[model samples]
Target chain A: MPKKIGSKTLLLTSSPSIIGYAAVGAKKEKQGPLADYFDYLSEDSSFGEKTWEKAETLMQKKAIELALQKCSVQKTDVDFLFAGDLLNQCIGSAYASRDMAMPFFGLYGACSTMSESLCLAAMFVDGQLANRCVAATSSHFCSAERQFRFPLEYGGQRTPTSQWTVTGSGACVVAPSKQAPYLRAVTVGTVADLGITDINNMGAAMAPAAAQTLCQFFSDTSTRPEDYDLILTGDLGFVGSRLLERMMQAEGYPMAKLHNDCGLMIYDRVKQDVHAGGSGCGCAASVLCSFILPQIACQRLKNVLFMATGALMSPTSNQQGESIPGIAHLLHISAFPNEKEAK
Target chain B: MTKQEYALWAQQESPKSKGLGDILRAFLFGGLICVIGQLLIFFFENRGAGEMAPVFASACLVVLSAILTGINIYDNIAKYAGAGTLVPITGFANSMVSAAMEFKTEGFILGLGAKMFIIAGPVIVYGVSASVIYGIILFLLG
Candidate 1:
């Protein structure tokens, strides 16, 4: 029997499918809206005028709106908003959240931002500190590329390990002490430095960081890989995820069964020629908010561990040649069978 | 003096006083940085470090550059790379250390404390200022 004392429960919930979330973005396309900004970006011009920050701002706002709409929660209903993105000084999150008027907190975890925000938001809900929480994270390739690497005009070759910055945003809402449909357990992440620092290719740079954090989370929580129906690592796409598994095996903590990397799952690797899969904070967030949440609603999965990994280096840090550090936070969302509904 | 004048002075002085030795030292140290980065990449690749190898190698390069910056070796390297070394991440580290050292004679607060944020100043200011403005707009609109 599962341990049950108080009637309070934490559950991970979202729209019916990941594609449903993608449909929100697709709607913008269907409207035949002029996305001239994106078009202007790919064209040859001076990079700064491309207005990447503006794009990041818009995407994040839209994501927040969708997540709120799905949760049946209004902006005013949320007590606080925790958000993050890869732009300079987290402009994407801060600027976007500014209008929402919820107490805003900006965060960064490279690709693993969603997990970080979720873990923090869940803690607030579980502790009864807040009644409602909203979290969002995003990454835009155009914005991140211009800030971190060469200008858009300077077409440089990206290596296989380099993950294309996801053109997406993910947002989630969690409510407090609500008996069901609430946050369950959360595992705060620790800095896991595998001493990797190649900025040109982040998957490898961040893989060891993700692996170390995942192993630590399991150890701390006293949970095994089989404890959950699925164990997902945020963004250790094709190469990094494989490397992470190998490292885990070497350490005698393998996760071969029911384990998937969100990075690889988000995009069609073969069609996209994405050697690895999707990455960025959006990769994990979109996967969870879109795909995993729907599965939970369907009662297809019971216990799930969402481990989001982040490369903690910034453009300034990378430029300064500081060693890239990484962090990952594991959040547990258990979907108990609704007794009434089951009957 | 302008940065140009300083360059001219160094050029003139080097020719008379052990110029060759200083030239050799700069070249040797500068070459050493590149070699170290290359060697790290090779070693990790050979050991099957795969994706992580580059991150680690780049990290090592940064650390090595930092130490060299401390000893004033990286300045010589800058002469060769011009802006190449400065443009990369390692160059940022050099700038931090170099700025800190320049102000070292002043007290820590006035020197290092004030100077640490020098290189990173613009980005931070822009980030915070933009957020504040955006926040105001959001408040008005929402």
Candidate 2:
């Protein structure tokens, strides 16, 4: 095993290559700022499914199918699948995986499930336990609304601090290969809470966790802000993104350039009515698959630290007056020139 | 740091609402909604509804609001108009229309019927009780 850099980060001894990835977003997402980044946008939010839940299931299925197809790996060839969604029992992922028929590990890291699955997949591939593993996660605006906030039928007035849940899915494959773009390291974050109660203002609830994990990652690796080409964070919407910067600036780090948020990237703040920005696990997941991965693949960027942040709260927990807790997972994704012919 | 202290710092660090622009938009759009309602009342009176003109006008207003919501116009207006769209009776119609539009999927019965009262339920409950309590007080005073 590679020597541990810090308290939370693990430097992978055998860095596993991210072989394939796919992103599927809904119509509203197509109209967003990163419209060109997605692999496909459903003509309708339903994607020809009868219900929002079923539609989400289809989206997850499409993402996984396309990701594996890109790597020339069939459903039968996939050793295991790691997947999750913002749904009761993660039904969207479960229903989709039942068809793939691979041994599955259902994860629940809330919005951070994408990175959690990716980290676990890298572990499996790096350990030689699996030659290839598929990681996927999905979220839908309607499904998340009904489950978390209020039924859309409620016509709940969104506060300015509220973020729009992104309707999308993202999937990728991790494999044992000596390749250019690979998972070099990972940092699993601890759950941090500031006792934030406003469900609409997830940005504030989640920012502290993001800041703590970030401080931990920097301290452990002894890395400066200049080391990474891009330091991307997941789902810290407009408010949280700025708040995180302020919180970190006080920590004695100058983080103006090279910092971006997937939530901010997923939607247009001015034109779109999404108050804060696009959120949900799908926001970061889809952006990583469609936009960030391509950047690495084309060598437009060399090194990036992708941190997927999540607010780990449940309907029961929130309803019962429990404070929202947040977590963030980090992956050190870097690229070098391919020695072999690039695929 | 203590949770409350951290919470206060977090809240301060959080973004504040652009109240001035929002208030102006809300006022202008709210005035526009009132103007439309008055126009409907005039139209109903011109048709000889006389004593019942306001009742007909209210019905027309509700229908107009539902249609606006159906074609996705109301939400666009509500996005900017803020309390202006919310203060009008049209907003009540919007709540019902939005509910049906959102819950139309679960086969119309359990989905639509069950969820249809999300906003109206609270509004109706308080409205009825308040009126009943006021009625008793007025009756006793008289």
Tell me the TM-score of chain B in each candidate.
0.52, 0.93
How closely does chain A match the true chain A in each prediction, as TM-score? 0.82, 0.96
Candidates' TM-scores?
Answer: 0.60, 0.90
The candidate 1 chain B region of ten consecutive residues with least summed lDDT is: B9-18
Clashing pairs in 2: none
Query: Candidate 2 residues A1-343, lDDT tens each?
Result: 4447768888877878899999999999999877788888987999998889999999999999999988899888889899999998999999999889899999999999899999889878877789889999999998898788754533235788899999999999999766656888888889999889888888888888888888888899888778779988889898788778877788876675878999999888878878889899899899999899989877787888888889998878988999999999888887852223323
Interface RMSD, all candidates in order, equals 21.4, 2.6
Report the number of the highest-DockQ candidate: 2
Distance from true location, Cα of A14 in model 2, Å: 1.3
Q: State in Å the error of residue B106, model 1.
A: 36
